[model samples]
Structures are given as C-alpha cells and as structure tokens.
Target: MTTKEIAQKYVELNRTGQHMQALEDLFAKDAVSIEPKGTPTEHAEGLDALKKKNEEFATMVEEMHGMEVSDPIVADNFFSCTMKMDVTLKGMPRNHMEEVCLYHVKDGKITSEQFFYTPPSMN
Candidate 1:
C-alpha cells in the first residue's frame, strides 16, 4: 500500500473502533509510536508496546467518530497528514480535535508515527 493509503486506513480503523486489528495490519513489528502529551509513556516501541498504548487510548475515550483527512503529503516512504477527530471523552463533552501525523513507512507498513495535536483543554 502507498503511504497515503496506509494513513487513510489508520484513520478508518480508528473511526470504526477496530484499533487492535488495524495495528496488526498497518504497523510494523518494530514500529515506534510517539504521543507527546499523554499516557503511560511518551514513546512506545515495538508492536507489543504499541498495542498496549493503543488499548490505553481506546479505553480512555467513550466514543470516536467523524474522522477527516487532509493535507496529505507523501515523499519516498514518509507521509504527513492532518486529521480531525470527533470524540466523546469519558467525562467530557464531545470534541472535535485536529492533529498532524507524520508517518514513516517501509514495505507498505508504518514503521514509525509521530502525532502533534493540541491538548483536550485547547480543543
């Protein structure tokens, strides 16, 4: 798959609440994920660690929907995209969040992903 395709699929999986299955197919075995602001750690490396982080996020949010992708730029094996995430927090009102995600892909799988987003408070 192309980098854009992989990025789109990632959003699709998340919107559909198929987090684990998406990780299995889209993420590399040795993938690294960086979510700078929240959770168990800032960085998670390897599939096992990444899976754990994903599960943690899934547990935190009550519902996720209305994903929109834009500004997709791909070069070589790297891609960057801007995504809007509509979600309901566990104890908060619905939110429309915007994030910029940079992806490093190889052999059609995402090897690394870095996300930049304003905190929930800012949203």
Candidate 2:
C-alpha cells in the first residue's frame, strides 16, 4: 500500500470501529508511538509496547459511548486526522475527548505516530 492508501485504510478501519485491527494491519513492528507530553506513558516503542499501552487504555474505559473519526489529510509520507470520543471510564462519568493524531508512513507501513490530546482526569 502507498502512503495515501495506508492512511486511508487507517481511517477506514477506525471509522468502522476496528481500532485494534487498524494497528495490527497498518503499523510496522518497530513503530514508535508518542503520547501527549505529561501523560503517564510518554512514548512506546515496538509493537509489543504499543499493544500493551492500548490495552492499558482499554482497561480504563468502562464503555465507549460514541466516536468520530475525521478524514485524513495526507502529504507524502505523513497524514493527520482528528478523532473525538465520548467514553465512560471505570468508576467515572462520561467525558468527551478529542485528539489530533499524526502518522508517518515508511515503506507502506506506519512507522511512527504522535497523538495530541488533553489528559482526561480519571476519577
């Protein structure tokens, strides 16, 4: 897949509620993830750490009420999109979260990702 195709597929999968699958299919094994600064985990390197980080977030969410994925804007090897989520965390009330995610594709696979979002206060 080309950069555009990979970016599009990433959006399509997430829009269709296939979050995990998107990572599994589009990301490289040694991909790096950067979380917003001041977060518990600032960065995760490699697929294993990424998967574990995702699982940790999943465990925090009691329910995902709604989600919105914006169309990606692709440029060469980079793509970006905004995502909004309404979720209820374990023992916490529902909260609205928004993030702008930037991805870098190398050799037809996502090699790095950085997410910008406010840190949600967990009750």
TM-score per candidate, chains pooled = 0.77, 0.94
Say which candidate scores most in lDDT: 2
Cα lDDT of model 1 by residue, 61-97, tens digit: 8887677767568787888878788998788889999
Against the true structure, whose TM-score is highest? Answer: 2
Query: lDDT for every model?
Result: 0.82, 0.92
TM-score of 1: 0.77
Clashing pairs in 1: none
User: Where does candidate 2 stray beyond 4 Å?
Assistant: none
TM-score of 2: 0.94
RMSD of each: 3.0, 1.1
lDDT of 2: 0.92
C-alpha lDDT (0 to 100) for residue 57 of candidate 2 = 86
Instruction: Report the lDDT tens digits of candidate 2 across residue range 1-123.
Output: 998899899999999988789889999999999998777789999998888888898988899999999999999899999999999989988899999999999998999999999987644
RMSD of 1: 3.0
Distance (Å) between predicted and true CA of 62, model 1?
1.7
